[model samples]
Target: MSPAVPIPEDVREEVLSLAREGVPRNEITRRTGVSTASVSRICGGPDGVSFDRSATAAAVQARVVDLKAARIGLAASVLDDVQLARQRMHGAEDNRAFLDGAKAVAALAGTHVRLVAVDKDDSSDTEAAKSMLGKLAQALGVAAGEDADQAEDGGVA
Candidate 1:
């Protein structure tokens, strides 16, 4: 939708009214009895979808910030009534609610996780090393030790 293209005054007004309210183009077209072409023109061509960094981009970037802010606010509010937020032994439901709220607080306040990368493990060398160690230990009359006490498990001294 290219807003740059001129629409008829009536169509332009109608489009703006519906658009400001977040109405879908199809709905706008249906309601206004206007063609999709007219709606697209009033919307600023789809090809020229310009998101001003300070506006649209900022809004997208701050979405998480907004969500965290809301979450923190709600988490705080959940405790305003001290009685409800208080923990009582044998109160599984209340405890669960409190723990859930605490988790939300932790999430909003903590350093969240991020995945770095994933690579395949080449275990041929590790297996070969382990086999050599077991053979050497057996030849030396030393206990190769339990399966859990292997090099890969960091259990070998």
Candidate 2:
């Protein structure tokens, strides 16, 4: 007969699923009733495992979907707070109060908003990126190039 499998496939798969789902390693240990050593082995040795090379890659992918959904829910909940901050910013009784509220709003927005700059140096594209960017910015009600920096820097645009 073949030598006994160190960790049964089903058990290993279960351990991987729990780890990818954001469960703490200790909790996974308790839940799976597997020894700490086994958990460590399955999750990759001491340094931890890379998702690409790990056996639990599929489970990790599933967890990514869950993480994205949680992020959407959190962003949605923050909408109400954002609206309130706007109101507070508008209704400040003094300059200091207004500045406080404005700062809060700006800081909060900074956390959730991301600016991505995609530079495509590929010469194969026929159209110039600068012109395309300009059009896109205008259509989106934003300033282009230098004007964009001015707007973001609080200058009248």
Among all windows of 10 consecutive residues in model 2, the one with the lowest summed lDDT is: 113-122
Expressed as tens digits, the lDDT of each residue in 1-157 for candidate 2 is 9984577878888888887776767777899888877787888954364233353787898897787777666665566677889899899899999999888888766655531111224574436777788788787774356677888899976
Q: Give each model a TM-score.
A: 0.25, 0.41
Q: How much does each candidate deviate from the true structure in C-alpha RMSD?
A: 13.8, 13.7
Off by over 4 Å in 1: 1-7, 45-157
Task: Write the residue-wise lDDT of candidate 1 on 1-157 in tens digits.
Answer: 8555445788777776787777777788899878877777766754333222365577887996776676555655544433342333224467676677555545433322211111215487579889999999796655445543676587654
Top candidate on lDDT is: 2
The alpha-carbon deviation from the true structure for residue 125 of candidate 2, after best TM-score superposition, in angstroms, is 15
Misplaced by over 4 Å in model 2 are: 1-55, 115-131, 134-157
Q: lDDT of all predictions, in order shown? A: 0.59, 0.71
